[model samples]
Target: MGRPCALREKEVERVFSTPTIQQINSDYAEFFNLVGNNTGVDLSENGFRDITTVVDFLYIQVSYRIYYPPLPDWTTEGNVKCNNNPIIPCKDKTVYEIMKEMNDLRFYVMYNSTELHKLDGGSVLTDIGKKFGEYVAGNRSVTYNIYSAHDSTVSAVLTALQISDAKQPEYTATVMVELHKSAGDAQGHEVKVFYKPITDNSSIEEKNLPGCPSPCKLEDFLQYVKRFEISDWDKECGNNVPTTPAPPSTDSLGLTHQEKITIIACSTVVVVFCLILLIMFVRKRSSRSMAPYLSLGTGA
Candidate 1:
């Protein structure tokens, strides 16, 4: 973790140096530059180390307001006035207006500027599609499946689904998929999607998936999501996994059958020759010992 950035520059460059992010970063810097020019005070004086600092601060406010409404409001903590600061762009704007603008900007930065949702959101879409498939086949017994995911997850899914009004999902926002079976003359299954915003828990907004009917048929829904479904995530993300080679087979030990037979014959011949030499040595020892015994008997 303490490694130098220079060493891992190539690995992380794609994230920071993408053309879309670069353009957004440029725009971000220009906004800060205008603020600095008019205020006669460097906003960077307050630990604004990078161009993303101001945008990140605004996002933090938005996030806190939605995610933790019970918490004390940080924006009004220091008697801060919207109109007193000429550098502040959202002068005389309500908190809701500020959040809305930031949310829109966040959505643009995350999805609108690039085709990243196709890559990042593919897995979530695939899982949802599989669930629909399972529900139709009666394979899934559980009725409700919940995914505790980040806002990016919601945005990516919406973008991948080609929802025309796709924007950044607020904190505690939910995306639900409902599978309904026709009761009467209608014999086909239908899929319905609903999004519940954090602002109103009681209200669930029904969305019309682009290129599909309001109550999309199970078959059409599956086909529509097929484009965004990811089968091999690692391959799609360009993650290369090392593979081990299989062991060689015993039948073919890199030698011809004739060569193996010749080896066996040579080994047999060597074993038989060693056995013959051992027998001859044993006989020679026996003959010498018998001669000594006969000489002793003759001398007696």
Candidate 2:
């Protein structure tokens, strides 16, 4: 299943919860009504009343028969069929638009603020910049640096660069940062950003960071992205709880084997002395009772 809405902001969490199936039906009643009219199936009155069922339905709409071995002849959004009829006949555009909204909302929740952008994408961009700087300085040999990341990373980087189209990143979405230099150019090396969406026919698309040229100069790109760079991630993310010092090791308690033996011997001696005193007290009381009995016998 796709990730649930990323309600990261306190206000967003406070204001929203998972929408019930009934709520979804109510909110998107018009879209559902159109689907029902076109397909002769009232989703609201059917098993779609449960949210899990609706989510499964949406999943089926987007990903149909793409996973199993011996994949279908063709698997695309166009192949989404209801009763063996193409979904396009049932207002597929509306369905897709709703899906897009779901993705846009999720992106907004995780990458809305500048700080969030830094926490999610700033460090990554910083590392790329530093590595590229190393390569330019002739200190690095590796040419390709690959990072496998989640959709949130893609969304965050796009948002940080102010180039996000506000669409939900599809599965296997990728963002690439490349360094380039023109032959003996006065401007020296430059940086370029490219993104590839998850669509079957999707190709890498060049993206320009806001206020920067298409092929942004390395120096200017570094300067622009510096605002998002973070030196201390823990401090920046407010994860600054003082660490609890580890407990002292038991072996470091400074007790020698001989000292331990001496202490145990002293404790045993004290216990034995107290036992002897208790025995004497008990014998004295017994003797006193016996003497009184002997005196009564003599009197008798």
Candidate 3:
């Protein structure tokens, strides 16, 4: 994070040398850069320390407004703190406008970012597909399936299905998938999915699961959902190199088989030559010592 321009460079390196802190610093810096470039604002003063302060404050404001409408203006609210200053004026923008802008930014980051959507959303999609598969296969006896997930979770699922139009789901938005059976239909079972809005209860936003008919057959629904199912989530998550252990090397410190063979042959030949020389020396020494005894005996 380049010492944050506030702390001593050496101290920052010493205190935040750990990988977790480094990652946090890295993410904070990226966010500051992205926001600063996009909004032309100075976030350097509170880059890592208070980057999310305003957003958090907005969430609180929005929360309070749920029960009590007409809360204080978010753009000119005293709740936001940056550089320890409150009530910063952001010309002529209101709470609703700021909220919408934030949502759009979030949608762009979580859904429109293709690689990120795939990497982050892939596992969630796979899990849901497996859950549905169990129900279709008659293994699960449950009458209903309910998924409680975050906005990003729902958007990621949609992104993985290649049906995301990259818009923020409104507050308390939900996507519901229902499975049913009927006697009149040729297919044994059928499926219908709806996007229910929080703003209006009467809206029934029925959307097709790409390449499938509305209220598709249970078999077709199963097959269509399986398209997003991954065999292994970890394999497709990213370019993580597999950590398989390699087999033991046989060559012994990089000596080839031919080199070992030549060395062994040379050693064997040297040993055999030494044995022959030793035998000849023993026979000659015995003969030399016996010559003196033979001469003494012959002197008689």
Best-performing candidate as measured by lDDT: 2
- Tens digit per residue, CA lDDT, model 1, 1-300: 122323123333444456644544443453444445543445432212233334444566656766555423433333223333322345556433443454454554454323355555655776778887877677878777888887767776676666625455777888887888854427688889888877555887788987776688788888877776556555555655567787644455786667788899999999999999999999999998888443445553
Candidate ordering by TM-score (highest first): 1, 2, 3
RMSD to true structure for each model, in Å: 8.7, 10.6, 13.0
Q: Once superposed on the true structure, which residue ranges of model 1 sit more than 4 Å away at CA?
A: 1-30, 33-103, 112-115, 164-166, 183-186, 199-201, 248-300
The residue ranges of model 3 lying beyond 4 angstroms of the native Cα positions read: 1-53, 63-99, 113-118, 161-165, 182-187, 199-202, 239-300
Q: Residues 1-300, candidate 2: write the lDDT tens digits.
A: 022223234333432333443344455555555555544555554222322223334554455544545322221233222232221132443454443444454564456566666666666787888888889889777999998887668787788788888765776888888899945696599888888886677588999888887788888998987887766555554554579988544446687667778899999999999999999999999998887443444553
- Candidate 3 structure lDDT: 0.55
Candidate 2: misplaced stretches above 4 Å?
A: 1-57, 64-97, 183-187, 246-300
lDDT of 3 by residue, 1-300 (tens): 111222223333343354543444454454455445544666555443333444554565664466455444334432221231122222344433443444544453444344444444555555555666677677777766666776666776666555565555555677777777745775477777777755556786787777776776767766655555445444544335569997545575687677788889999999999999999999999998887443445553
TM-score of each: 0.57, 0.56, 0.49
Query: Model 1: what TM-score?
Result: 0.57
Q: How many residue pairs clash in all the candidates, one count each?
A: 0, 0, 0
When 1 and 3 are scored with lDDT, the better candidate is 1
